[model samples]
Structure formats: C-alpha cells, structure tokens
Target: MKQTEAQWQSTLRFAVGVTAAFVLCEFLKWLPSFLAAALVAALLGNLPIRPPAKVAIGLLVTISVSALGAFLLSVWFRGMPFVMFGLLAVWMLLAFHKMLGGGSPLPPLLMLICLATIPVITLTAPAYADVLPIALVRGMVVALAIIYLVWLPWPAVQPPKPKPLPPPRETSTLRLALLATAVILPLMLVFLLFGLADVLPVMIASLMIVANFDPRAGGRQALALIVANFGGGMCGMLLYIALSTTPSLWFLAGLLFFATLAFGARISAGGPTAPVYVIACNAMLIIFGSSLGDSAGSFSLWVTRVFQFTVAGTFAVGMMELAWHPPVRLLPLRAGRSSGSSPGKT
Candidate 1:
C-alpha cells in the first residue's frame, strides 16, 4: 500500500514536470501542439487506458488521415467550406470504420481528429498559407513527447481490472442526419450574410466536429475551449493594438509565442481542462498573424471566427445528444486464466 502511494506521488510529480517541459518546448520552432499531444498521450497510456503500441499506431493513422484531408482541401476544393466539410465527413467515416474494426481504438481516432482539426481549421482561411509543414512539425513534436514520457521508469503497479465490453448500441442515423443538416444550414446562412461562403463552412464544420465528437471528458471541455479562445483573443488583440507600431514583427511573434507557451503549460497542468490555454494560445497566433497583414481587418476576422466556433459547437452538441445516443463501452480484452484451473487443461 505504501509503495502504491509512492508510485502515485511519483506519477503526479512526473506529470507536472512533463507538462512544464512540454510548454517550454512549444517556444522552439520544432515544438508546439504535437509535443503537447504526445505528453498527454503518454500520461494517458500510463494510466492503463490503452496499450502503447495501439496509441502509436493510432497517432500514425491520424497523421496520415490529416495529411490526406489537407491535400483534398487544398487541391480539390481550394478550401471551400462546404465542399471540404463534405469530403472531411467522408474521410472521417472511412477512417473510423477502418481503424475501429471490431471495437478498436475509437477514442484515439477522435483525439487525432481533434489534433488535426486545429491545423486544418486554422489554415483553411485565405490568411494562413502553406501551413501543412508547420502542422506536420507540430504533430511530430507531440508524438515524440508521448513516446518518451510513457517509457520513463516508475514503480510497477497492477493494471486496472478489465471491464467487460458492452454490446454496441444502435445510433440514430436520423438524428445524425438532422444534426448535420442543422449545422450546415446555419453555416450556409452565415456565409451568405457575410459573403464568406467559401470559408464559413470549413470553420463551422471543424469546430462542430471537434467540440461535439472529439474525446472530451465532459461539457466542461467545450466550455473551456470557448472561454480560452475568448480570453486569448481579447488579450492578443490588446497586445497587438498596443504594439502594432513596432516594426520588429519577428521579435513580437517570438515574444507572444513564448508567452503563450508558458501560459499553455500552466493551464495544461489542470489536465483535460487545459484546452482553454491551447485555444487562447492559438487565438494569439491568429490575431498576431492577422495584425501582420491589416490591423483594420484583423479584429473583424477574429470576431467572425469566435462566432463561427460558437455556433458550430452549440449546434453540433445539441444535435448529437438529441439524435444519436450511442452507448459508451469498454474495449474488450481476453481474460486471464485462473492459476488453479488452467495448469493442466491445455
């Protein structure tokens, strides 16, 4: 019992230290969202959530799917919102079906989708050009961080008791269809109203899927993301308004990036609730990047983005819960044989 307590303490310390380090790494060019993701993955793995190999494979699958989606959006649709969303839906369905055959790692796919969505949504706008490289680098950082952390030496503890897998529940296909329609219709209306029909769908779809279907602990996650982005955007706007006079764009970017990293780290220590920090950090990135272009236009763009996310998330969640009440089930595992009965049976 004492040893177990010590192990738990050690795990807590490691989690804290790793989170700090990951935040620090975000300041570096090669480090960012990916590193943060990896750290989270590692911590999760240690908790008997899933196997390390499965996690690694899932990460690779996510990267591949994301890259493919990016290509489709860039080449075929030129980032048209609705078109891209349609394609994304198809891709997600196919990927989900393939990866989760006979009850595989569904959560990882959702997690990866969330990770990939960050870049896809951010870059879908005309403002962010050639963002694929940056996104890939970020993913690498995350994957590496997770691998390292999971392998760290810690006291061995008994794995949690394997829960019995529940039978698959029927999803209300009609609800999903309705939800999709509801989300898409408003996005279309917004686009028509704003003359941004090309980009509105992408933004809305990304946020909707992320907040609704991504691996969330609870409703608090969606709330955190929204609050974080609002706070971050407000702060970023203030900073940009105050410092736009300076000609040193690189220096300003660097400063904001590091500051965001530190902030992200502090908030991430709060566990899954840390998405608020990430949202805020990304908000800074968008605001700063926009300021570099035209300060007059940046604020409007920021407001639009926030609004888009809000609408998408709200609609998605409402539709999902109301329509498809899919049951959550544990992954099935082969039971271990009893010591006495299995000795001579074979």
Candidate 2:
C-alpha cells in the first residue's frame, strides 16, 4: 500500500513538472524550448531523488565546454571536410568508449551531441553556428532551474538507489565504441553532405537509440524503440490538433498536464516498458515544442518529421543488429559445427 501511494506521488510529480516546464518554455518562446521539458521529464522519470547541486553544476560545465569546443573546432575546420569528419569520428569513438567503460555518461553524451550538431550547423548555416552553443547552454540552465523548482514542491519518496553496473572489459568497450561509431557516422555523413538542418531530429534520435541499445536484449528492445517513436509522433499530432481548436497557452498547459499524466502512469509503473514510455514522452515534447514554435504548423511538416523519426529508428536498429552479429561470428559458428561433426576424430 505504501509502495502504491509512492508510485502515485511520483506520477503526479512527473506530470505536473513536465507540464509546467513545457508551458513556461512555450510562453517565453525559448529557443529549443523542447529541451527544458524533455530534460525535466528525463530527470523526473529516471532519478528517484533530486540530483545534488554539485552534479548539476558539473553537468552544466560539461555541456558548456563541450559545446564551445565543438563549435570552435567546426569553425576552424570548415574548409576541410575530410579532416573534419576524421576528427569527429575520433571524438565520437572516444566518447562512446568512455561511456561504455563506466565513466559518467553526461560528459560523453554532451560531447557526442555537440560534435554531431556543431559541425553540421557550421557547415550548413554558418551564421547560426554561434547561436547554437548559446542556445544549448540557456536551455540547460532553464532545465536545471525547472528541475529544482519542481522538486521542492513534489519531492519523490527516496527509494534506495540501484548499484551501478560494472564496466565492460576493455576489448568489449572498444568493440561497443566502434559499433556506436558505425551506427552514427553514416547518418552524420548524410546530414553533413546534404546540409539537412531541417531534419536534424533524425540524427539526434539515431544517436539516442545507439546510446541506449543493449546487445543482449537485441531485437525486442529495438522494436520497442521504433514503436515508441511512432507512438510519440501520434501523441504530438493529437496535441497539435487539440491546440488548433482552442489555441491558448492555458489550454495547451491543460492538455500537456492530462497527456503527461497518462504517460507518467506508464513511466511510474516501473517495468521493462517504463523506458519506452520515457522515450515516447521526450519524443512528443520534441515534436510538439518545435511545431508550436513554428508559425504555420503545417500538417505536411508533422508528417515529414514523423517519417524521418521512423526512418532513423529503423536505420539505427538495422545497424545495431549488423554490429552485434558481425560476419566474423559466422566463421566461429561454422567451425563449431565442423568440430561437433568430427567429435571422435578430435
């Protein structure tokens, strides 16, 4: 009974917090407004307790430094495509290695995001390159503020934290890094080659999928990810349609509150599918927040965005399968069969 009560408390907290963050961002017309709400949802859903001040500070510092470094590097290497891509690949590999090797995930994740985003933005829209880093910093600042404020009123019941997983062996870590690079680089190249800033979310989604993927879980988790993306897209579409009918910030907030409550229930259920709901909520925020900012909010644009996310999820899943079960695995399998057939000869 106590556990059930705690679960409901957490659910209400998540719903209220996410809704408040989204409404505030929309009202203020913050650039990259979705980021604040998404971050709030992530923190509230994943962490049972509010993060310490020191950890929050460290994260902000990491975000700022990584974004600045990536932006500067992109600017310096704007004229050299091959050199830029080579360096970016190296950076990505190192980040993935650190993440897989039990290092703090935020630094590497921020580094990877900055590395992917800054270079592409620099290449395609040089004028907007300077703005990207600043916007990221500001979004993070807002997210942090929202996190603290919401936590004050709706503190979660402090469950015992789970033990952190042991790091993979060095060889395994390296292999995982290579796999991540393999999954990301091709998609990054496509965006860079075409300068497709409009569909930037696709690359971001691919990166997130790669970061969260587990080889042991395999295709089941992969399918869940794809389904989550579509589910989120559908939610975004529904929210947009509802907003169209009323077209008020308060109404938007109410819609978000109710919608988040539904998502929050799933998230608070604490099962395998919890992570899927989290992803779906973040996806909904990204799509809804960005579209809300646009003046036109065209139906075709929403369709295109949904299609892009689906394609990106599919591509990432395929790459992961290929990576996890490489051609080399077949040689071992064949050798095992041959040895089994001639067991007496051995």
Top-TM-score candidate index: 2
What tens-digit string does per-residue lDDT give for candidate 2 at 1-346? 1346767778888888898878887788776677778767766776667779997898799889988988888888878878888888998999999977774566677678777777788888887888778877787787778778776766658465456455444338788899899878888778777778754456556666777776766678988988887789789888998999999998999999999998988887776678788878877887887788778889998888888777877888878876776555343467747656755564
lDDT (tens digit, per residue) of candidate 1 on 1-346: 1335434534443344344444344445432322343334333433433246766666556555565555546456644757755655555454444433334443434433443343343444445434543454455446445445544644444444455354345443333443444444455445444555234224423442433242223455545555665565566566566555675545554455455446534442444444445445545444443443443556677566556545554555555544444457777654555343554576
Candidate 2, residue 101: Cα displacement in angstroms equals 2.2
Q: How much lDDT does candidate 1 score?
A: 0.46
Report the CA-based lDDT of candidate 2 relative to the real structure: 0.78
Error of 1 at 130 (Å): 2.9
